[model samples]
Target: MVVPEPGLPAAVTIYEVGPRDGLQNEQGIIPTATKAAFVRRLLAAGLPIVEATSFVHPRWVPQLADAADLMTALRAELGDAAAELPVLVPNERGLDRAVELGLRHVAVFASATDTFAERNLNRTVDSQFEMFAPTVDRALAQGMDVRGYVSMCFGDPWEGAVPIDQVVAVGTRLLDLGVGQLSLGDTIGVATAGHVRALVAAFAAAGIGPERLALHFHDTYGQALTNVHAGLQAGVTTYDASAGGLGGCPYAHSATGNLATEDLVWFLTGLGIEHGVDLTAVAATSRWMAAELGRPSPSAVVRALTPPTE
Candidate 1:
């Protein structure tokens, strides 16, 4: 006796964060120029917001040892791109590198679950937020857009279940610090539909309206799209997805890819929602990326688009 998924707004925005989140976790470090091509292809394919790289120290994330170089190359190639390519900046040093290169947008992250904060960022809750404050101020002062990410909003891999208030308190601080969007991440893909509804409701009651939120769900347990429905029902219109379910949380052991962007678009369109993205082209783009990455794609849309075997 459950209700059908509620209708979404006439239009919704999908921010693609695959390049930064998806590629960073790979054990092999993709070449700098190769990373540039990933950004170029996604931008050419017309993704609205592509998180290009992270400015963490090379020792921390050797995968992005060439963050500055990638930016220089991508920025030059922005000539025909229809989207914004931003980087992830976790603190002052990371943000400083971004500012030095005249970057316009960057994302910062924290965890609703304290265990993740320590495991992921190796800092306590308050210390991590403090690390972000000056970076937020500098980015705002420089007229850059900031997207704040809260990992494990629904449940944590190590911490069992995160309290709703902790999610709200951290999210509010980021929003208060001038983040244009707060992306709630089901980092471990452990959220059920019921869990999704409860957390979104809790966020709403905390005076943090739906407009400022986006859901970033992982598909580890195969219930991500169902959780997306629950998220839509709770009034969140924006979503963060990867082109071919290409991203995962590095800190979450055994956590799998995100809800595929093409799958999300397909789901929304089938339900008569308007997302203004070209699904056919996106599927093609996913195929291209999968080929480049030398891996089989996890996206259902790409699978559907694959030619039938003889």
Candidate 2:
């Protein structure tokens, strides 16, 4: 008898967050020119979904201070492709900005952990949703694509352990708010394969499933690959990854970062799954970005496959 593979599919859509999520955490201000070019290159690599930028307060996130400028530039530069660029709006104000700029897809964020809620959003976990209620309503009313983020699904930096019920309740509320999809995030990368399996099972029991959910994970402790395997086994096909493993949770301290898109593509490719992304180009771009940041490439595959410059 032959053993069949796991939830390996013929194709997958990678929502690229490197421009917003990846660059937001960098210590310095990335030049607007470089940021725009990054988007151009990533889109050129055949990535269908690329999160362009966040229209948030510069005081809260200085790195994205050029959000407006970047948004305008990407749209003008990409033209028709600009339709695929989605911006993140943390609240009503941010959403307003995105709408004014004529963006069709936008993301709203929340946390499932009390500790992160207080530190990150300066409100209780539930209150953050309340704050976002009006914006979500406005977005749905305007016929926009809304993606809800439920962060800290696996663990928390301050709270240490997070409850499964909290995640379900928060996710359920987001769904009730009419979110087209819920992206469960393991913010600090402390999640194990067993925990991944359990949480997906819990979400399933609570009326959430792969068809309406996405998984975002950080590779801080090196369990990201295994977590991907687990998410697939749980029937999830959509996953979020950064280029070259380039992002980390801002609310998370001493953590590594997001699962590299290149790594995810490599894994899927090995499984004979079509990710519709150019892995070779992804590796080159990862190397370039790592060089500009003056840091070691976090992606092991990139380090091995990319030829060394003399």
Whole-model Cα lDDT of every candidate shown, in order: 0.82, 0.85
TM-score of each: 0.93, 0.96
Give the least accurate 10-residue stretch of model 2, judged by summed lDDT.
Answer: 1-10
Model 1 alpha-carbon miss at residue 252, Å: 1.7
Q: Give candidate 1's TM-score.
A: 0.93
Question: Which pairs of residues collide in model 2?
Answer: none
Q: Encode model 1's per-residue lDDT on 1-310: one tens digit a residue.
A: 2223445565667788777887777787788777777767666666677788899878767777888888888767775341256788989899888888887888999888678899878887777888898999998998888899999887876778888888888898888888989999988888899988887777788877888889999999999889888888788888888888987877787678988988988888777777777887888778877887888789988899876750
**Model 1 regions more than 4 Å off:** 1-6, 80-83
Clashing pairs in 1: none
Which ten contiguous residues of candidate 1 have the minimum total lDDT? 1-10
Q: Summarize candidate 2's per-residue lDDT along 6-84 as a digit string, tens digits.
A: 5565566788889999888888889998999889889888888889888878887889999988988887897756755
Candidate 2 similarity to native, TM-score: 0.96
Q: State the local distance difference test value for candidate 2.
A: 0.85
